[model samples]
Target: MFNRYEADETYGLHVDNAIRRVTGSSVTVRADLSATLFLSDPEGYDGGELQIEDSFGAQRAGFELPPGVEAVNLKDRPPLPRAVLEPHQSIVFQGMMGEAPRWEDLHWLQRQTELPILVKGIQHPADALRVAEMGLDGVVVSNHGGRGLDCLPSAIEVLPRIRAAVGEDFPLLLDGGIERGTDVYKALALGADAVMVGRPQIWALAVAGALGVAHLLRVLREELEVTMALAGTPTIADITAEALFSGP
Candidate 1:
């Protein structure tokens, strides 16, 4: 979930498991992994920190919101609680957002993750090259599905440039405007190691829930297979940049 915090807005320290009621049923799922991406320039915001605790209880803090924000739990049991802190008061924890990441943060993240870390929403070749220099596992070329910034170019438009910058061995993924199997094929041919489908899956789920999602994926896979065969690319590895062309 992309959460945008305005001035003084804060999310109290909490685990990510969420409860959702769908068709009069409550469903809960635990996330195996969590990723936080900072969109706003570090200098542009204050106090909206991405703070996390390690398994050993050590803490690190990143981005944050403005000062004077106090966290209150209104649903606390026993007696009703009185306001303890005023709006102008800023609380400091063991982990504070006073320091932001430059080089150390990236190295810290790489050290912590056993699984491969792929940074997403990268549109610039320089950013892709930076990801490689930082020793990141991969990069996803995306315009954030065009949901965050409407004016940005599509992921496909930048895929080749980023791919060229990162070199052939680096894994690159693409996300955005993928409505058909042909779209997926095009992305792979254009240099995306893989493609992500977003709204189509949501639309399918909205129409028929799990069954719809399964059917839609099955259809997409079949269509992709047919496209590959018809285009004379028998395998995914065979798909190349020559398969794509620009049009007026």
Candidate 2:
């Protein structure tokens, strides 16, 4: 598969290669599926449209690539307006639309811009170290928010190891099972720079819309403040490793 990173960078209609170089030397990957992840916000840039033609392949029985999908040459068929399609409807057509981007890719990405890049989906300390070694802006020690696989260790369980790997100053974010202020405190005590709450925010949004979300965030902040006060911690820096303990 190919990636277009810059604002003007574009990939013409083309097929993917079977093998890809994972490292700078010679390590390669065999790919069976093609995916795309739009890293930038939609409004952040312009003219980067992921256009797939009908001739390339059949996406579904009913929703075939598009009429006359056999045109190999991109010049034969110009890209259609992707905005015309609804947001959710494109999911089926774009199967597995992101990738486990490699270290080399991240390194190259760092060279491309000055903006900080935070790699997500880090579950191992080794991987976290690799991220830090790459000089990335930050990392999120997560299990894809527990959406990837079954029987994996929780994010909280691996937080300290990753913290140890990257050291104290590295910005490390943790995601998964963070439901309340106490949970946030626990994550911070274990060495996370911050905690990301997912389902809780969604639940709040579903129950009370924007106001509910705002109130939920306020309540979470208040709860953490109260938790800190009760724990004899007056500041964020005071909630160190000493604030936590292993339990039976």
Candidate 3:
């Protein structure tokens, strides 16, 4: 299950029970993995822990690694040595069943799973490299739509630096100020593998719920196709930094 935690919410063992009831089996019985998304300011509160259950019925605890530690390589170790969060912050974890163990136990499980972990809401090249070091699959350069911190660098502005940090062949995604195909194009030129749209989806949901969302997606897809054709790019792979230039 993909779970998201907001500020002031403690997702305890009850989550296990809920998953069991909904899926008609325990989390261990059904899920091979789980990813939790955190959407709060880590500084706003304390004790919101993300606990993962191993196959042996053991629970391993993990938390968001503090900011500025993105330079720390977690490839063979834990990405977040400790829990950390700021508003609009998020992390992904690989869930495997085992005995509920201490931080060390969780670290062991993370090393074993070897799942591709990617963090969103990153804006610094150093931070991106740190994520890569943690052995993350990649990163999504984003500013949470300016929702988390004011005066934050736009995701586009930081893409080049982040790409340079991670090196070529590293999968990089982009988010923020992405409302049009042109925005997507710009992100690709700046060095992004893909882009995520948040506000537009929310707006569609608010205006029309499910149907509105469907329409919104359709519109975006059409716009992307048109933009691609106009840019003379026949495929996503063909769109590159050469297609863009610094404005005069």
Candidate 4:
């Protein structure tokens, strides 16, 4: 889940409620893992630190990034415009891991049997390669939906480079500028394992709450299926780079 506001304010309250509803033991089928991706630097604003609670109701990780120059480490890419967080500024943690061992436990679990964790908002293929080498499950090619930086390459345009950096079988998720089934198809053909829908999903929720969101997902799914059929692809695996062409 993404939190754009400070953690001690109204936004934090809302997040708590959402978590209760989604992962409370009484809800049945508790969530095995949860994470928060920071969209802003800790010093950029104030009070938006990420606080997590474990299954035992203990605050597991309450973290905030360092501010200013301290947050900008020498990454693989040449210097580029980017928001820098303070040390301990980024909050990343796993919420839960089921009994018995699994891949979910491999990355985040050693600390407490947690699930794998990853940080997104990456652009450079070298950066993606570095994260994959750290044993992360994958990286999502995104620009925070164009909200972070202007004139950034669309996620689609950078996906193949990231895929090559990470390797053939590594998972790569994409986010940004996806508005139709063709967009989804284009992303898949370009090597994205999955795509995330943001603004459109919010618009649906605003228009009709949960039911509206469900309807939106259904429509998108049907559209994607239809697009797949028309493209002579029978299943998700059948989608390949050959199925797409650069825009005219």
Q: What lDDT does the true structure give each of the candidates?
A: 0.74, 0.76, 0.70, 0.70
Q: Could you say which candidate leads in lDDT? A: 2
Mind giving the per-residue lDDT tens digits that candidate 2 earns over 89-178? Answer: 332244223333557898899889999899988888899898888788899888875556877899889888889888889999888888
Deviating ranges (above 4 Å) for candidate 4: 1-113
Task: Report model 1's TM-score to 2 decimal places.
Answer: 0.58
Runs in model 1 deviating more than 4 A are 1-103
Please, what are the lDDT tens digits per residue for candidate 1 over residues 113-169? 888988888899998999999889999898886887899999998888898898999
Total backbone collisions for each predicted model: 8, 3, 21, 11
Residue 166, model 2, lDDT: 89
Model 1 error, position 25 (Å):
47
Residue runs of model 2 more than 4 Å from their true location after superposition: 1-100
lDDT of 3 by residue, 1-248 (tens): 44456657654542222122223432222223455555456455444444564432122345555776554455577533332322222222222223224435434656877676667777888878877776668788888878778899888988998898999898999888888878877888778888888889999999999999899888887888888898898898888887776789
Expressed as tens digits, the lDDT of each residue in 151-176 for candidate 4 is 89888889988888888888889999
